[model samples]
Target: MRRLGVWIRAKITLSVLFSLMVFFIFLVTVVITGVLFFLAHFFGLINDEIAKGGIVLPIIILISCILIGTTISGFASRRMVKSIREFIEATKQLAAGDFSTRLYLKSPPEYRILSENFNRMAEELGGIEILRTDFVNNFSHEFKTPIVSIKGFAEILKHDDLSREERDEYLDIVIEESARLASLASNVLELSKIETQTILTDKQMVNVGEQIRQCVLLLAAKIEKKHLDLELNLYDYSLSGSKELLNQVWLNLLDNAIKFTPEHGTITIEMKRPAGLLEMVFRNTGSGIDPEAVPRIFDKFYQADTSHSAAGNGLGLTIVQQIVSLHGGTIVCESEPDQSEPDQATAFIITLPSETSK
Candidate 1:
């Protein structure tokens, strides 16, 4: 049905152009014939020829011009109609999930531009399709693995032949798996909310430095357990933003730092006003991130640790980025991965407006 509509529109366009050309030819012929007759009557010229031949030459010239003009117009309209048809077909193919659809027009600069943009759109759509497929498969695997573990552990616990120690171990595994499942569900929900949110709620004046300190204090136990050194160089800085969302950013960044840092490793956090923007950096000493992985680090369900050995469900950074962006902020990761030096580390830098009225 849509294809039919497109065909009808193209036909109408061609018809209109052709009709305009024919009308123009007719108008020109009438004006020229009228002028010739006027001049002949005033100067008494061609009157005798007209009386004998009844204006046969003018009539023949008009017919010839109309025919020639109509043929040229038809030829011109054919190329345009062909380009339009190609676009319509490409649109249909794209709608049917063929992201490889591309256009290559040869004539006309305008058509070339359209073709270039169309191909670019198709390429982008193809990339987005791949990402979407990866997201679904990753989400399913991440979601199902914990449930399987929980089920297996639950089954083992139901055995009356098991010893007390074995039962306790199995119970612990089941509990941990259940917690993992809960965390996965919660992260998925938070990501969905942030993805759709375009505005901030519960907006207030949030102390940026204080939030980092609070996050540090909250994770003090982990820091001590890992024997990691915590260094804070926070100066008083505040921003108008969503307090709840920004807190998530700090918690995730600090937690990730603690998770990846080595024993006695240095985790340095510095806050300063740089280029009129409030800048904060969280650096941790470890085998930093891979260069290739840095670009996709914040993508939803993307995890550098593909082994699933980490403590997160891969939604933390994605959520942090969304929250920061909602507050008109930016987050970037800089890491010197696999360095020969012992002090090599990964760092995340975040910047935001100091005081947004919104």
Candidate 2:
């Protein structure tokens, strides 16, 4: 449970031992010299000249040993103290919201490990800090949109000169804007709960085909409105996960496809067995994700393009990824701009363990 560096501990131990050894050696030498001096005086072998010369030798040896021991102990203690102080300061900076701070102590292996762990901690903190900042900015903008729309429509409704039809239209706009705001808030809350592990799922073996059909039915209106083609190649695949959560996952993915795909564009859902795993591939002929943004596509509040800001608050993919991970699965994206074939198109491939059905 003691997480301090090994080198510092070793250094302290060695310093103490060295000091004790010097003391022991000095003590033994004094005892032997005292016995010899006493015997010499009693035997009349310590005359004035002999006594003077012998006294100076013992004094010189004792002084030299004391000076050497003190100097070595002081140097060793100073080095250990400096390393510990640096480590403490680095941790304090990290606690104070400075995630970039790191301990540069390179004295011993233990210090090295401590520094490495500190760096890892700092990196994690920095990542979370960035995510929090982005979430706040995105949340504000998402809320602002609906509020602006509602305010504009409400002001129009306040006009006594407006016709009945205009007033009804304004009211409808207000309602729609309110619904948008509610939806944004709901999604944000769900994402937070999922990320914080507050939302538990009752996972069970589920038919992927049925789930896809249900999601498709939910988005039937959007698909028809956009005039997009739906192609299904499901193979009665079953996945072990929360049915409700997985249903949401499919809905978000397909919904995103419908939202981005142009009229006459095609959205395909394919399930296949590959390498003892159940794989679901959702490909859409929508605007391809930017290569630069592909790495962070699943990151919360990340959008490929700012123009699509009106479409979503960008937490949909983040939620989808979390749900998949909860099911012990992985999701990957393959996309290229304006590609001809389905494989070349923007595709999301999700792989789940096939054993979930058992």
Candidate 3:
């Protein structure tokens, strides 16, 4: 047998029709019939008048019930109509880039829930708009800086009487600027790819500790340049996840730690499984991040060190946070300022549920 389906509009209409039928056809008919019979008995016309006016009484009652039911249904359905019209208007405004528009529904519980959800969606859209604007502005500025440097140095290298040292220095400056531009482009592309990925497709049993160790070793040159003391206390723990994505997380965190750690500072990488959760911490001793800047550190294009002296596009931590979220995990940062010891540390602590945990 073939099955049929009623859509939302048809269902709503059918519901209103059913309600009207119950009130007007069934309940109204029964009440009016009882009233007419009582009146016939009260006026001492039960036998003769009942037999003569039985059909007439029912016709009059049915007409009256239809009129009353139409009036009440009109009022109730009008509210529904008004709510739907308002919802359509709000959606149009949203489509036109008006994120501030919201629906104030005072009609029914279901409509109220829909309005609340619409408002929440509007809020998220507004936030994304802000991020987009910031990205465009910041990207332009970042790209412009390297171009300016390359142009200025290339002009200087045109001098015929320049010394070898001066020529080499200008060439080095151009090279560094070009590398910076390339890095920025790569980071932007990576972020765009990750944002569109809705699921972690490549799952594997990865050695969490070994992956982190490799990330740290990859940045050994930078660590040596800073003369930083490296401490590693990794526990043997494996987890089922996307190794490629998690590797990016560790590399970004370690790179940030190396970038911010002062000369001759201390850096620590610790991993442990506690209560069926894999917790990894990367801590570096240096000028700690401010408490106010902690909340927005994971925001795209957000840099706590805003001096532009840092070798970053402000997307590393943002990528780290996104990758962690994809794994159904959490990442947090904590810092303590130095009073006298000068051993203050800033830490990025990541917690993930271990699949191997019994």
Candidate 4:
């Protein structure tokens, strides 16, 4: 389909040139032949003309017309080919990671449109390249930090003179850093796996509200540790999709809510079906997300808390977003600073189509 669309748009110029060249040659042949016949009859020398060359004039005129028409067509064809060649070469450069290449084509609406689209694609590729480079740098730093901490703490533990309390603390720190490293590795692998999936598999009719409740219960310990108040208004709801994937969505969101909410903070989970949309919202009270960070919160390796003080590798929300996308859903986050709103605060809302839509 895409190839056909391209051909339909690009073959107009060549088709017009070919048709015009054929018409020009035919017209010249007819007019030249008729004029020669008339001149021979007017001079009453038809027999003399026949003896002299027998249609030689019309044959010469026909040949000249064809040559002229061909030459003109060739020039037009060369310009068209040159422009196409430029597009091909630019595409090759782009494929080679040269996102800076841009087209500056002129004339012919089709070629102009092609150039504009290609340039826009190049610009997007350039932006993605930048994001990829930044992700790699951030990933390396994140991966190195935990490993270094573990190594440093282990080295300290090697001293026999250290008291029991000091040794336990050092060992705890090593254990915590090791866990962080493992979590980071797991999130990376999970994100890679989910992103490569084009369609959701292992789908089943899952009680989504029950799933959210289970996620909240699973994190009950952490919620209790923080002395946070939890509210669940989960009306019974079910969705037809990959159960394991949806489980990750709820788990990640609830875990994030637990991680970021302050002690004695409030966390609320709500599920409802409104206008054929299965909407779930997780709201938590905290310092609130930076307005600037809200837009990029789902981006991989982009953390609102850039200080790394939070125990996240920034892939949780990314994974959540991807899973929701695979399920043909949308997730959005809105935040307000402390005291900017009533008791309710920063919220992440996810909406999925009803099972019938699926």
Candidate 5:
């Protein structure tokens, strides 16, 4: 059907051009034939009947050709112009966010290709639009949750009937909710900067082992509270990157391990030079990520568990991945259900290129 439309459109355009050419030829033929006939009559080169026939024949031929040409031209021009107008209109509709609009044009192969390209573009636009809408909706809901909790808690604290302990408890709840909101906002802004390539990294040579140690220290309280065993196998390995961003990577990973790992579970950190690359691995006994969620683990605002009980805005892994990419490094995760232990075992392996390894 589409092919037929394209052919019809092409035919129409050709017909219009042919019609114009015929009109031009008709006019020229009539003028030249008239001049020749007049010259012959005036010079008496031919008899009156012959001259008259000559004049009449040329006029008759010119008139017949003009009529035929005009008819053909009109038919071709109409189809061609109509097809072009339809195509333009369809394009406008698409530009106006109507992805369903399609150009049913009968044109040549070139025009058919154009239509196909347009359709493909529209399909991509539609998909992006859907993603944008979903992102916006999800963002709004995420933002609203903390704000509502903070507001409710603040209002409760305002009541005079509440005792000192009750007021303090309410204020604590408000403070916690406020912190959650702040964290969410920060993550959103950071992700935007990363996506836009606006965030600059201050790269420098630093000890990767020390960075892991710092991260473990930061989460030392939580690890102790959980009674988790901490193990470190550090070698003299270093990496060149923004220390602050790299710290965030370690902090988020270690934090996640502490959060998910059960009591008495073990968390291990290892740094070594392997195959001319600096490799850092953080492993923990925790609930292994579901196979379905593994692919989306690094996606911004994506939580494997939708309940939001986890202590994160779901942007931690995303930030880690982005930082690693900025440093021209790679990170991977391996996990298995630890049936022998009380929890699953998961390991995150990070490899920095030898050129950047110090």
Candidate 6:
């Protein structure tokens, strides 16, 4: 609450101080001029002709007051607008893609607050610019890698002397790369669409637990192949959101869990309503994410522990976060490199409001 009023208080304080200073300056000038006149009269220094007819002293005193006031006002105005000019130039630099620009205002509490806010904004913009550049560079590399692989393998397959098994393996490689490229393109388009959606549409009262189980069934083949021990600690929790979108969230999370989980590892899906908000946790004994990388795991094209996670295009979590946001929920990755225990390993926790309609 105090923060809410800080800017208002600052503006009022500044205006009142400026008004008081101006009044005090003129009052001082008048007081000094009156004292001079009184001294002259007491000393009999002003002749009767000068006092009654000339009016020279009074005019000169008035002119002196104007000059003093004008000089002080002009100097103060220039000082004040110096900050404004700095602000304008900073803004120009910011618009020119210089997210490093900052402001440092000392006087006028409002501009100080503005300076702080501007620095914070610049910092955030700088981080975003870095992310954007990384995304483009990563996108180009990811896009080109599969194409090069496909072309090279196709050329290998074109050799007539190749054995049947060799030709079939090359063809499989080509098909896999094509599928990967298709998935990447589809995810990019989906993320673009989801990012532009301000409000959730096609909402229905979805059975959250049932939806998760269905997603598990979709990836049952992968789980079986990995020999993963799957656990379900879910309850009947309904949610009001797009069922299809939420399905994507679980499928991607489970796919990642399966992709990284070693043979005979555990995968657990638990949904619980504690404090009235449903907390759906998907945990797997997969590769642990570095603590520093956890915060940026959702960023587009950010893959943590790339050595263990090279196969992914890194858009899954980004899409999951966007869809979760559309549903007015939050999703987080709570995995640390130190937490390598099977049950206490990497986990994705999604929290959402339970449906009142249920």
- Clashes per candidate, residues 3 or more apart or on different chains: 0, 0, 0, 0, 7, 0
Rank list by lDDT: 4, 6, 1, 3, 2, 5
Can you write out model 1's per-residue Cα lDDT over 60-179, one digit (the tens) per residue? 556756666666657656767888999999999999999999999744555667889999999999999998999899899889998999888888788899999999888888888889
Candidate closest to the true structure, highest TM-score: 4
Clashing pairs in 3: none
Measured with C-alpha atoms, the lDDT of residue 302 in candidate 4 is: 87
By lDDT, the better pick of 2 and 3 is 3
Give the alpha carbon lDDT tens digit for every residue of 125-193 in model 3: 999999889989988988898999999999989989999999999999999999999998999899988
Superposing every Cα of model 2 onto the true structure, what RMSD results? 6.9
Ranking by TM-score: 4, 6, 1, 3, 2, 5
Give the worst 10-residue stretch by lDDT in candidate 3. Answer: 1-10
Model 6 RMSD in Å is 4.8
The better-scoring model by TM-score among 5 and 6 is 6
lDDT of each: 0.84, 0.80, 0.83, 0.85, 0.77, 0.84
Instruction: For model 6, give the 10-residue run with minimal summed lDDT.
Output: 5-14
Better TM-score candidate (2, 4)? 4
Q: Which regions in candidate 2 have their CA more than 4 angstroms from the true location?
A: 1-72, 198-201, 341-343, 356-358
Q: Against the true structure, what is each candidate's TM-score?
A: 0.80, 0.79, 0.80, 0.84, 0.68, 0.83
lDDT of 2 at 86: 89
Clash pairs, model 2 backbone: none
Q: lDDT of model 2 at residue 183?
A: 83
